[model samples]
Target: MATLPGRRLLQRCAAGARCRLLGTVAEASPPREGDTIYVKRPASAATRDETSVEMPMSFMTGSVVGKRFYRDATVRRADDGNGWTVMLDYRTLKSPAKRPLKLPSRTLAMAIAAEWEYQESDGIRPFTMPLMKLACTALERVPVTRTKVIDNLMKKFHQDLVFCRSPDDNELTIGVHQKQKEKFDPILDWVNTEFGFKPVVYTSFFGGKQDGELTQAVETVLKKTTDFELASIDAMAAAAHSLVIPLAIFRGKLRIEKAIELIRLEEDHQVILSHYLSLYSGSCFSGLTVQCLIPPGR
Candidate 1:
């Protein structure tokens, strides 16, 4: 598993403490308003030097900002040779907590750089750059909040949308129940086989209980995942409202499109019903009006 460079090491390097001097590079253009400028200075430069600016952690707060500051965004290997880092002009990127943004792979670093490259001069929208947000969350938040994250997922496991079945007896829900059985039953069966305990399906809006062993099994799987994997799974689960769906995707048992279909099953069904009702009503009303206008003898 790839790890981030230690915080203390990066802090010492940032402070220019007992390190060799490297040549400095200046920004291509002057920074605009609200731009946080960080220049990678020579290691021998004094920490208090006016020319040297450490990368501010506030830049990674993922907030909306005005104007693009840098002329270019690029990726480079870290000086320590631990991992790849991104550069806006000459400044190395840092996390919200001021730790070095050491990405495990060059491809990921490049993808993030691409996000930066796409930013417009009028605004820098953090919402548009999902990859960067994911990286920051994995690097800055996951380690500190792992336990709470896992607990939240588990707490919602019993109430997962996939586990709550519509009653088959109701006329309005009969079609939905059939659809659920066709699409969801097989997944439940897979869950049973994989965990060695069948999940309890609930018709109640309140949700149902799963076997304690099954809960333990799922929690164990979550605990064993890497930080990046856990972060991704958490995001997927929140989107789908089903921990099982994300786990299935992670295990390669489900495709992303299919997971999306499952997530919107009920909503999609409602759309179909509305369309059919509109057509039926239009035809029936037209037929009645035509009959009313016709002569009785004819």
Candidate 2:
């Protein structure tokens, strides 16, 4: 069975992959006094009706930024290297649209929508192959919409996450977002089948089994919390290393570059767990660590 810790490791990889895939690389400037601005769907709440969604590009303020926008964008991979060089420029025109462009081939597309969207949110998107591989871990084939795409990724991510919540024992437990529950199920099934992932198991002393009360209570608590998953072989190692017991990181944003170091902090596992086994304890990490997690021990 994929252990509890393994589930979280897997989720992090899939989440990072998903984020990197759609995150656009963009920069923006505050709107000037009179320029018209274009916004996509679900307009910002701060604006009034007619102008609720539309803002003069000129009236923008604060860190209003622009992200990588392709008047037209294209991508092609190097025959020998493991990366892709994406090309993009401005101009609205149609490329051959009979068939979708395949990977390793240059890609181009055009939007024929009545009104095109202009977005200001910015961040770096994930690279392709990794995104595809991560998606394939659960979905037999990719679906077309953004919701479907996110669902597919979450399914793969959830498979290993259940281990952290099994009812038989209690170590630590976290919940999934309500809106994101369906997206997480397929992943749970996949991880359970392949990694021996178990559900959150716990027992409690109660007055009685009257009125489905206990189950309701358990469900209520689970519904309120959030946690990462753990499943694959690689995740197994990351989870074991993370048993920081007291110092392990269970929350907060830890990026890839720092993730590597975070995993390393617990690599030996014993390094931070002195009472369990000291001989194999990891060497002290020079960078911020449990030390960062707490104030100097009293």
Question: Candidates' lDDT values, in order?
Answer: 0.74, 0.28
Q: In candidate 2, where is summed lDDT lowest over 10 consecutive residues? A: 107-116
Per-candidate TM equals 0.76, 0.20
What C-alpha lDDT, on a 0 to 100 scale, does residue 224 get in candidate 1? Answer: 98
Best by lDDT: 1
Cα miss at 158, model 1 (Å)?
Answer: 0.3
Model 2 earns a TM-score of: 0.20
Candidate 1 C-alpha error for residue 122, in Å: 1.9
Off by over 4 Å in 1: 1-62, 76-82, 287-298
Per-residue lDDT tens digits for candidate 1, residues 41-117, read: 66675642212223334455655554556654667788788888877665677665566778888768867766766
Off by over 4 Å in 2: 1-64, 67-70, 79-81, 90-193, 196-200, 203-298
lDDT of 1 at 57: 46
